[model samples]
Target: MSVTETVGQTPLEAASPFEMRVDLGKDVPETDVRSALKSGEIGFLHSFTTGSAVDGPGIRLVAWTTSCMFRCQYCHNPDTWTLSNGIPVPIEKAKEELRKYAPGLKAMHGGFTLSGGEPLMQSRFAVRLFAAAKEMGIHTAIETNGYYGDKLTDDELAYIDLVILDMKAFDPVQHKRVTGMDNAPVIEFCERLAHLKRPMWFRYVLVPGLTDVPEEMDRVAKFAASLGVVEKAEILPFHQMGRYKWERLGLDYKLAATTPPSNELVAEAVAIFRNAGLVAD
Candidate 1:
């Protein structure tokens, strides 16, 4: 099948900076966006959550889009890692789902969140989705690995309300080894994202000896604090809830021997980032 058929829509016109830049590499030009949207060339998304309290500040409508370019060892959603794993529901349908919880969202002052195996992996879809959400006055957020930030246009940056950047590891070599990619893009993405002056949440998975090293945590903390855009620094205690996915998929459970960090350990990591002048949540 063609890429368009796979995704189910031709994207809307490249009306904003984000759209034009994101689609710059394509054969289609920005001038053709309106026609494309009218022609239904841009396919809408599949599904989304109506109410999620954990992803952002208030209750949130989350769109967990399928597809990812990375293969992290401890990923909780290995099932969501593939582009073709889930049913395609369309973006309008997704919005309809979010509306069901609109009353709750207004009560909690919450909005919409887009997350995935790597949302950036589906940047085109994300750009389209964000545009749609923004038109509806929904406060939009993204939970991403920061790998695709640089590749986007400035206009795209304007649509997002918040960005929660996940730092896989402070050490580049370890990060590449663990996540099957280098850390340079992730780091560069963060720095460029800072220029947008959007609220950012830097999250790290405290993987015992692997990611909890005092020196490394300090380095990460310092880097994040230096960014000046971080609204919150969160230390996510590593867990094995997804280990079973790896087992079921017949993939190697490299971190299988690893245990979750103690609350004290988590606290210590939190302190390091906090001490560096970043808020820890």
Candidate 2:
């Protein structure tokens, strides 16, 4: 299938800095955004949630965007893989939504997290939203796979306060097996973040048989340690929670019978990173 066909919409055009940039406290009419949204100049989002604690530090307003390049085997939201599957909310509407939760977020030391089907797929929108959030004095974070990390400019990234990066695997072959993508871009993204001294939380999913290998875990631990800016390493135990989504979508669900890692295994994986002198849980 063609890229557009696979995504169920044309990919966003490369946006010039002038077009992507948004000013703080400026209100743009919703009617004015139709042309941009239709042209993929803005973003198509799956949905947004308020008071989500797991996406970032403290409570957060999490925006889940649509369309991803990776077909991760463990993805719970397979329906999010296509652009047409989402609600086409313009960037201004998104900012308005964030505005509702801004005061509470700040009072609680919380923030806004842009999550996805890879938020970086709509890099321009993410950058704009983050920039606006910073203007409101709200902490901003992104939950990304890092494939499109190169899309953001230094000025745009300056608006972001933290990153929650998901590093699927340390080995190239195994990484491809899990996410159907190369790890090179992800590694490059990590290196770039390190160079920027960006604070980050590293996340890894520990599937019982698929990713529980000690040697592979060690490689991940070592890489996390080398990144100096990693504030935390989260060892997420894999679960079959999303298998139903694959079944409903009529896609073959791999790892259907693969069980979640035991609590002991989770502890061991956390220990590996802790042993490497990184804070892990």
Give the local distance difference test score of model 1.
0.70
Best by lDDT: 2
TM values, all candidates: 0.81, 0.86
Which candidate gets the maximum TM-score versus the true structure? 2
Residue 266, candidate 2: Cα error in Å is 0.5
> lDDT per residue, candidate 1, 29-62, as tens digits?
3444334334333422324555577788788877
Cα lDDT tens digits for candidate 2, 1-281: 32223223422222210111111102324553444444444566666767778888888888877779998888877777875555566567678888888999999999999887788877878888898899899999999999889988877788889989998998999999999999999999899999999999999999887889899989988998899999999999998766766777789987899988888999999999999889999
The 0-to-1 C-alpha lDDT of every candidate, in the order given, reads 0.70, 0.78
Q: Which residue runs does candidate 2 get wrong by more than 4 Å?
A: 1-41
Candidate 1, poorest ten consecutive residues by summed lDDT: 16-25
Model 1 reaches what TM-score against the true structure? Answer: 0.81
Q: In candidate 2, residue 258 scores what lDDT? A: 91
